[model samples]
Target chain A: MSKRSIIPGFRLSIGISVFYLSILVLIPLSIIFIKSFELSLAQFWDTIINPRVLASYRISFVTAFCAAIINTVFGLIVAWVLVRYQFPGKKIIDALVDIPFALPTAVAGIALTALYAKNGWIGSLLEPLGIKVAYSPLGIIVALTFIGIPFVVRTVQPVIEDLEKEMEEAAVMLGAYRLRTFLRVVLPTLYPALLTGFTLAFARGIGEYGSVVFISGNMPLVTEISPLLIMTKLEQYDYAGATAIAAVMLIVSFLLLLLINLLQWSMNRRMTANS
Target chain B: MAGVVRYHATTKKQTREKHIDESLVVRWTLISIAVLFITIMIILPLTVVMTEALKKGASVYFAAIAHEDAMSALRLTLITAFIAVPLNTVFGVLVAWAISKFKFRRKQLLLTLIDLPFAVSPVIAGLVFVLMFGAQSYLGPWLSEHDIKIIFAVPGIIIATLFITVPFVAREIIPLMQQQGITEEEAAVSLGAKGFQVFWRVTLPNIKWGLLYGIILCNARAMGEFGAVSVVSGHIRGRTNTLPLHVEILYNEYQFSAAFAIASLLMVLAIITLIVKAIVEWREEVQNIHL
Candidate 1:
């Protein structure tokens, strides 16, 4: 069987994939590293450490982190409802959950701004309460959370569907209460998937640009996200500064992604072993 | 003895009922929260896009969509998707096929590499291309000397889009192909079918739905991409600007109704995409049940 491969076009497939990946992804991405090298180490450090840049980072990280946390809690609830219970319009709700993935970020940005702008629908209501959503850090969280709603739901939905009810039943048979069975017996099994979803949402939130840019009001050192900072630098013809900031965002997200993959891999291994 | 046994039986039945599902109050409360969250987060924004677009009237909405700049942006967006989606679909197929059909070293690495774009910020995706083919880069001089433009042009838009969306089709198809395994193809080959014949007859039919699913998703993203395309588009109206960027331009210029009018068109596309996706998923599930 090993003497010759049975598959046809194997060589062609491998060749095209490798070549395409190199040109489209690998080669272009390497340019960031090469461009950043042109700046002296101190200059690179200074650009990223600039107070304005630091403020943007703080806003981006804090908002994205909050968005991820929010998504994890509510997304889990959504997933559980979709899996565990039947309701009117369940199918519609299931389909609607994916809108954030399908809708253009630009459209979402405008629509959200209109909704949350003072005197607008939700905004008018919030304004009466002296609460602001549009053109603030809160607005950033709103957009990030909007885009992030899908990640946790999609990740956790399948796990919930596949959950072994027998285990929960067994816990009950042992005289455990309903909430206790859920918290101790069910939630632990879901932790890995939940964490994966959280990181994915967080990573996407950190890099988000189009949706946040409008509603954020883009106030310097106040509402600017890191990705927008990269754009601001590019607009100002500060290639060195842009490259420095882009590189930093890129590395941090890559580490987060690596953690997600590790978690998924271990989860898959455990799943197969159990089966 | 009989009274004692009756008491124990009643308590046992109570425990079973309680343990099986959440109490009615808890269930309804969870449902209410999920519904309320979805309305505030997802449904309301969608309604706003449509209402705000029509706030002026039908004629204004029509004029906004028909304006030369809006028309140009729509055309450019379609063109970019026209180019990017097909190319990426082909690449996705090839990569998915290669990785699933063959075994080699560092296969995990290849999968991770494909996912790299997802992890990277969209702005950075555009920046790398700018750094590569921008006038400031090493190749910039060579490209300019050849009188060719990449960064801040249509080609740059397509390239950045390609970078951002390259993984969608492959990521969708890979696991599917992996799950289906190689048995069917081998069976066809043993029946004296050639490689191309086997693939076309056996493999293609099996993965057709999955491939369509991937293409739909890729098309949606290609058309909707804002951040990366914005970086490379240079925002030249009627020439380089795509729809998302055009929306940004109008909204920033305080043309609220017009901006939303154009945005409503894209939102329609998103809705249609969702509907189509739902149908595809339902059909796939039906097919799975039959199998």
Candidate 2:
């Protein structure tokens, strides 16, 4: 037999794929690193470590962490309800979970701003209680939570569905209570999925801009997020400063996400081996 | 006699536990909390979009969308999607075919690189292009000398969008195609069918639904992309503004009715995307059942 491969067009297809990926995704991304490297070490350090920039980083990370935690808890509940129980409008609720995915970030920002502004619907109720939802750091958390919810729900839903009912039944038969069984038996299987979802949500939250910007009121040191800061730097025509901040966000996020992905992979392997 | 009685009582307890789910009170409480959260987080914003749009009369709402800026924004949004989606579709199919069909070294690395866009911020997506093509870059001066404008123009908006949406279609198609191994294609090749014919007749039919699904999602994102487009678009009224940016400009200008009017249009598109996605999911479920 000749040593030729059975599939034809392999060369052409692979060539096109690599070229497209490089031109469209890889090369453009590398420009950020290249441009940022042009800055002197001191200048780069100053640009990324200034007081306002530090504040934005703090806000972005803290709010994203809080939002991810909140999403992890509530998203589990939402997924559990969808998978374990049947109710009226169940289909509608299931469809509604993806709205944050489908809705434009700008629209989400405006709609949320309208509903949570001091004179707005929910904001009006909270105003009497000395609470502010819009144009504050709290508002950033709200928007992040809103967008991040679907990530957790979608990631964990399949795991919940795949869980065997016999395990829960066995626990119940052995005198374990409902909550105890869930905590010991069900939650372990879901732990990796939940963590993966949380990481995904946090990563998205850090990069988020349009939705957070309007709700945040774009205050310099208080509600500004890292992505918004990048935008501000660009607007001020401070390209080097913008590139420096963007590079830092990119490197940190990429590392964190990579770590999470590796962790999830190992966990998934162990879980499957156990099963 | 006492031991037997105890055994009977334990069996009775087990039966009760098995017969019931969570207690009704607990079940209802979980259900209520989930529903309430969904309504507040999702339904409220959607309702607000519609209510605010029509808060004024329908005539005013119509006038808002019919305004010159809104009209041009809509046109630009469509043009961007129209150009970007097909190009990405072709790339997605090619990449999916190559990665799934061939056994190459560092395949996982390639997959990871494809996923890089998803991990990166959309704002960064816009910034990277500016670095490449903005006036300060090395190529920027040469391009300017040649009278080529990429940043703050239609091309800039398209490039930013193309970058942001790079992975959607490929990510979707890759998994599906990998699950479908190359046995049929091999058989076709042995039967004397050409490569193009085999791909068109055999593989294309199998991946049609997935390809369409990817296209739908990519189109929605391309049209609705705000952060990346916002950076590169330069806020040129009636020119570089996509529908989402147009909404921003109007909202910033304190024209709430016009903003919501345009936002309502986008909301409708989002709803339609969800419906299409739901249908695709249902069809997949049905197909799974058959298999």
Query: Tens digits of per-residue lDDT for model 2 on B1-291?
Result: 443454344335343454226887888999999999999899999999999999998998999999998999999999999999999999898889988888887777788788888889999999998998999887898999999999999999999999888898998889899988989899999999997898899898878788888998899899999999999989999888899999999999999988999999999988998898888878776666555
After the best TM-score superposition of candidate 2, give how far the Cα of residue B99 lies from its true spot, in angstroms: 2.3
Residue B141 miss distance in model 2 (angstroms): 1.0
Task: List lDDT for all candidates, in order.
Answer: 0.90, 0.89
Worst 10 residues of 1 chain B by lDDT: B7-16
- Cα lDDT tens digits, model 1, B1-291, are 443454344335344355768888888899888988999999999999999999999999999999999989989899999999999998998888888887877788888889988889899999998898899889999999999999888999999999989998999889889988988887888888996787789888988888887898889899999999999989999999999999999998999999999999989988998888887887876676566
lDDT of 2 by residue, A149-222 (tens): 89999999988877777888888888888889888998998988898899999999999888998899889889
Clashing pairs in 2: none
Q: After superposition, how far is residue B204 of candidate 1 from its true place, in Å?
A: 1.4
Reference A-B contact fraction recovered by candidate 1: 0.80
